[model samples]
Target: MSLVDSLKDIHLSILPQDPVKIDTFVFRLHYFWTVSFILVFSVLLSLSQYAGDPIDCIHDHNIPDDTFDRFCWVEGTWTRKLGFDAIGGQMDKAFLRKDLNFVRCFDESTNSDGKPHEDCWQHQYYQWVALVLVLQAGCFYFPRYLWQIWEQGKIQSLVSGLDRTSLIKGLQSKNELQKGEIKDKIQLMIQYWREAKGTNNLWAIKFYICELLCVLNVVAQFYFTNFFLNGQFAQVARQGLNLDENDSILPILAECRLTTYGSGGQPQLTSGLCVLPLNIVNQKFYSLYWYWLSALLVVSILALTLRILQITSHDMKKFVIVYFYRIKEFNDVILKRSNHGDWFLLIRLMDNMNDVVSSLFLDELEKIKPFEAYRADE
Candidate 1:
């Protein structure tokens, strides 16, 4: 229909289908979207950079092709002659942040001490991008994996038959005994949910911690990637939007040099200009990654802050319960007696279960007489 819907369809088609969603939408955004983006980018970049000649060096007329290419690609390449150093912003010399000026097809001069010139930054990070992305995907996935194991289908076990509106409608056709069995199952769910207090606050604190971990991981990944990319990965998107490439860690062109004996055994010095196509792809990938991760960070921070408010503010919790599920008629008794863990489980139920089932659950919970006394006895 629309362009947005088409894109959504494309994204969904690539994602692995799961019958049960154990996490929230923002949580899924972290582990699913972030991880998927990394893995896909990693594979694509690997294909582009590794499957062909990633670096092509146009060498001196006397130099052999194989020697120049191999030496530069394997050892390293450098931007020998840097341009005017005045960039608009603060210069980060730790990562060889320099002006975008690669003039001519010649090599840089060695220092009097035989070392590479100080201005020439060695370019060896082309092959490292794919591996870094793979590692980043693993980092993004750890929180989800831990939560999946800790969740252990607790919500699924409780919300089994109560997931759809049709469950209530089908109650009309069931035999009396069948209806009784279903009601018994609902009661069992109520019992276990109430008993989650006994079972380590319904494991609710642990789940909230996992969610917190997701947000922390998102923030941490930014700094980690910046370090990996020589302090330029996080700023790539903003810098790209401003049309600035001087400070970019991934350079487009660099210089390569090789010294070897000729066919006649005379010592020869060869210098060439290497055009790096892989860095072009790398800058694009990191720029895209920057935008995605920035959006995810804002959303996760908002979600996590709201979660904290819901836990601390009774009015906030009540508003959420009433607003999301249309459970406006439920008694206030259960809300008074329920702890954060119990409320957390109920919120999960409201999230996963159909309106009819969730409302029915609230009705049953409200009818639990003097739940405070029941708690005291327990």
Candidate 2:
């Protein structure tokens, strides 16, 4: 049978056709989005580690303005990007400064720089690396789920016509088959049904995995939003703190004007480059809110891991036998008995059911051995 054309054989009518199509499409889209989100999440989480520190934005005499507006996104706000300094002194000391593309460096005169400084860098790098590794592992983990999905779809399509074919053949050949031959054929058909059920379970795993990816993507988006809205902006300007040693403001107003507008003085448009919203940053940061979010993320990760284990533990090989006979209509296949001449067909059907059930039971028993032992001990 042609690969694509064969799909029509499976009777998927029990399911709303449009919903299944929509669901399949959504699953595919989610798979793509999940992988993409993981990569982006890793990068952002790494960046956030560096940005998390509350670096003094106040340098020289001037209070660094919206240089840390970028942190607002990480803090959970998506309102607007932080404004950059119109003057020369930028908030370069802040690790997440729009201009600082690398790790933040310490100046000898900077207040936070000294013996304890090395620890800061170490913590920052470690957190960044850990989050990046998480994203990398997720990349490797998702494919097994996708493969299970493909296998299930294939089996469903292939098995749809097998039952009718077998039943029709059996009825027509009923008078010709010897008793022994009829018994053998029936046993074979039973084996096919067992195999089909196993195949159905394989598709279940794919469905579970697709759901997992969707949840992960949504969680990442939530964290991204939180980090943007609540994160601290550096109070210092790029060129020191705009102050003298005595915390005195140098007469620098004539040199630069502090306005909410851009260099041209028109309302600075930062939306094109940065997508964070800024309106939420002014709200009070609540520790409980963060705790709740962190808990949710942890729970999501655990749930996904459990689902993965469940999917992988499934025996894909079991489905191979199920699809072999390719029976689609279990109810339609009627077991027929003929005169002694037709006894052959009746015997075959009974034998097929017996052999199929026996083999499946044996296999299932093997799978339950470990669990059974544990239960017994308990």
Candidate 3:
């Protein structure tokens, strides 16, 4: 086998048959798309930043020289130390030269005079945001992992057995010997499930766990977006979209400060506001955050709705209705069949019903009266 096929075999051997694959909606939205988007976006963003220098000098003619730009590059990426002077509102270079003391942004520290403080890097913001997105992707997938851990093995085994049974009984040969073999196989499958009582109750528990995880994932996303993204992007997007009052407001992007200090400072740290240059990148990051949050909200709603329907389909009332419906359909087949066809139809119905209701309907089938050997027409 090729390397690709070998890897596929290894993966399948490890995971076997994952239960989450049975729920295509949840698997696609939560497990596949959500995780893929965040991680991919993070990688792209990191690559873009790494490929090109994140800081560049402004080409505005109003400034006297490139001193401010050079100072910013040396100071740090996020420090906003070079803006309008407090004494004179004008942002000219002369004012900055005289009154402005450009210190590296550093938080307050209790160190003695002349002690060195840590230098803050501007690219750290991008790094932090990327890390957060990667973490959120993992969080999004955690529930699916929980489901697989708790229920995947049993679900895969059951599904595999049903598939094997269907393959064996679906053969088109008309031989009496083959028909008898199919009947015996069908009877054995029914007896196996009948002996496996309370499996339906286990399914109910699994369904409930799936439902709870769906809701929890949604709630966690909202909380992480609001608090973890610094709420800046979400707030701005809401305002742009004219949303109602929301308590989770984001911090001002430009006004945000990082602590750094100059090499010769009195060991006293100072704060610098993020410059306008870095604010552009911050805006883009937050914009993407808003888009991701909105998409996640919609997908979570649809996935949760689908999960509820799947769970409800297994309830007692619905189960009884489906059971009777299958039986009535099976009886209709008996009216039009010879002895051989009747046996074939019965096994086919059992196989079809197994996929739908599994052991629940099979146990019910065991309680029902056996079909007559003679055809209805006879």
- Highest TM-score: give the candidate number: 1
> How well is each residue in 1-378 modelled by candidate 1, as lDDT tens digits?
975575467557756646555678888888887887787777667777768777788865666676678788788776532233445454434334433344222333434223565445566767787888888888887887898788888888876765454565554432421355557777887787666653546477878888888888888888987877667675577667434353235767776667677789875656677777877777777888888888999999999998898878888888887887777777666766677877777787767655566677776665555565655555
On a 0 to 100 scale, what is the lDDT of residue 285 in model 2? 18
Residue-level lDDT of model 2, residues 1-378, one tens digit each, is 863343234223211132112133234433333344344444444444555532212223233334533232232211111222336545333323323222222323442222222212111122233354355435433643555545444433322333433544545433333245444543444454334433444445455555666556546645553443233212212223322210101111001111235567664222111222111111111222234345545665665665454334332222322353343222111111112212222222223333333233233323334434544555
CA lDDT scores, all candidates in order: 0.70, 0.33, 0.45
Those runs of model 1 whose alpha carbons end farther than 4 Å from true positions after fitting are 1-15, 61-67, 80-114, 163-185, 198-202, 241-248, 261-267, 370-378
Error in Å for residue 235 of model 2: 16
Residue 320 displacement in candidate 2 (angstroms): 30
After superposition on all C-alphas, the RMSD of every candidate to the true structure, in Å, is 5.8, 18.6, 11.7
TM-score against native, each model: 0.79, 0.24, 0.50
Task: Give the RMSD in angstroms, all C-alphas superposed, for model 2.
Answer: 18.6
lDDT of 3 by residue, 1-378 (tens): 975576457445533553323443544466666666566566555555566444444332333224444444445343223333557766535324422223233333543332333421133344355577777778777767776676545434434434444544644332322345444554555554445433445544554566567657767777766665444445556544322111112212221222335577533233333333333444554556567667766776776665455334434223333463343222332223223222222233344433333333344344423323333335
Stretch of 10 with least lDDT, candidate 2 = 245-254
Instruction: Write down the worst ten-residue block by lDDT for model 1.
Output: 103-112
User: How many residue pairs collide in each prediction?
Assistant: 1, 54, 10
Worst 10 residues of 3 by lDDT: 244-253
- Who wins the lDDT comparison? 1
Higher-TM-score candidate of 1 and 3? 1
Arrange candidates by TM-score, highest first: which order? 1, 3, 2
